[model samples]
Target: MMIKELEKLFVRDLEKLRGELDQYPNEETLWKVVDGISNSGGNLVMHLCGNLQHFIGAVLHDTGYVRQRDFEFNGRMDLNQLNEEIGKTIEVIRSYFKDADSETFDGDYPLEVFGYPMSIGYFLIHLQGHLNYHLGQINYHRRILS
Candidate 1:
């Protein structure tokens, strides 16, 4: 039940992330850096995608995803590629979650991501929060730059 809810929110926000990227005027502006804003909307989408792919997709389910953390922030993708990546991220989440049971949430997470063990359920919620935080940043970035 918990995993289902989390998965829904994750997919919803990821779709929104894709929409945000598509809404950008162009690929260049998606990666634009102004005086006040450091990270562009494109970079934020990439970061969120990688973050989820690594944590939920790879870590929890062993999807064999290799996450390049730095490139997530530095990399540039055109709107089409960005949309595809986010779509892939969404499928990754849904793939594991479709078979996930309540027990999947109660166990300890495979990694001590913050230097201490945390429950899978707790860590999942944390990941969701992280996703939304960046999603908001991307939305604000789009507004400010536009």
Candidate 2:
């Protein structure tokens, strides 16, 4: 429940997700548009990176991170680029967690992002869950394509 514990879990989960993503045949393979879906693999990767960056920015610096919400619906990125962005996101998130004090997680700092009231701790947990959910989708798409 502590920040340190949460950080470790986050890192572990991130590594697992990245490993799963690495199993995809290629970036172009991921970019292949699935019929009837609004989002492609590239879009999902960007959205995941953006969300992670947004959470870390909010908690670490109180800065608002700009997310291309609509772009996430129609975007294409190379696998190398997506992997690089994901790596950077993981580093930022890990650093934020490492430096976070107990007070950061103790009090309920309500946020209005996502159009819902969320405590700081709850937000972090939600983001982690979101990442896991998308990672599953990415893996499933890979399996389907392969």
Candidate 3:
């Protein structure tokens, strides 16, 4: 049930991310950072994908995903490519949760993210929180830019 709920939220946010991509008149629009804002929607999407893939796929499931943290903020990805990436990210998270049980979720996380020990479930909540935080930013970014 917990994994279902978490996966639902991640799917929702990924949908929203795709919707934001749809709002852009062109791929270049996704790369625009408004005045005083740092990250574009493109960057945010890359960051979100990289973050989840690294934490969930690599660390938790041993999927060996390598995250380019800097490129997440610097890369210029096409809107279509980003949509594909988000779709893949959703699948990765969904697959992980599909086989996950409470014991696995309750076990210690592979890494001490944020310099503190935390359970996988707690870290996942944190990851979802982080996802929503950036989701909000992307929503606002899309609105303001359009």
Candidate 4:
């Protein structure tokens, strides 16, 4: 039940991320570095995609996703490309958890992501919250640019 609820939240937040990507006036705008903020919105999008795809898709579902964590923060993607990655992320999250059972949620996450192992459910919840936090930053960046 927790995974299902988290699934809904993940999808909801990702949809909101898509909207944020849509709101950007241009690709260059999404990558602009504000005076104080070093992170570009485009970079954040890539980071989110790489992070979720690797953690949830690869780790949990054996989806064979390989994350390039540095590229996520350093690379740039056009709006359409970001949307594509987001779409893939959404699909990965949806299908992985669609048939998840208690064992899936209760099981220990394979990696020691935060210095120690945690339940899959706890990791998923952490990831969902992370998404929302970045989503807000993207929204704020868009507003600042506008």
How should the candidates be ordered by lDDT, best one leading? 4, 3, 1, 2
**lDDT, residue 103, candidate 4:** 80
Which residue ranges in model 1 land beyond 4 Å of their true spot?
none
Q: Compared with the true structure, what per-residue lDDT tens digits does model 3 show for residues 87-132? A: 9899889889888988888898978878998899999999999999
Candidate 4 — worst ten consecutive residues by lDDT sum? 1-10
TM-score of 4: 0.96
Error of 4 at 20 (Å): 0.3
The window of 10 residues in a row where model 3 has the poorest summed lDDT is 1-10
Per-residue lDDT for 48-124 in model 4, tens only?
99989999999888899999998899887777889999999999999998879878788899999899989988888
Candidate 2: tens digits of C-alpha lDDT, residues 1-146? 58877787667776766786688786667777687655666677788888777767654455566667676657666667777877877787777876678777765656577887756787788778888888778777778887
Error of 1 at 118 (Å): 0.3
Give lDDT tens digits, candidate 1, residues 1-146: 46678889999988888778877777788888888888888888888888888998888888999999899888777788788889889999999799788888889999999999988888988988998898888888888777
Report lDDT (CA) for all predictions.
0.86, 0.73, 0.88, 0.90
Tell me the spans in candidate 4 whose CA falls farther than 4 Å from its real position.
none
Q: Highest lDDT among the candidates is held by which one? A: 4
Rate residue 17 of model 3 by lDDT. 81
What local lDDT does model 3 show for residue 61? 77
lDDT at position 104, candidate 1: 80
Please provide TM-scores, in order, for all candidate models, with all chains considered together: 0.94, 0.84, 0.96, 0.96
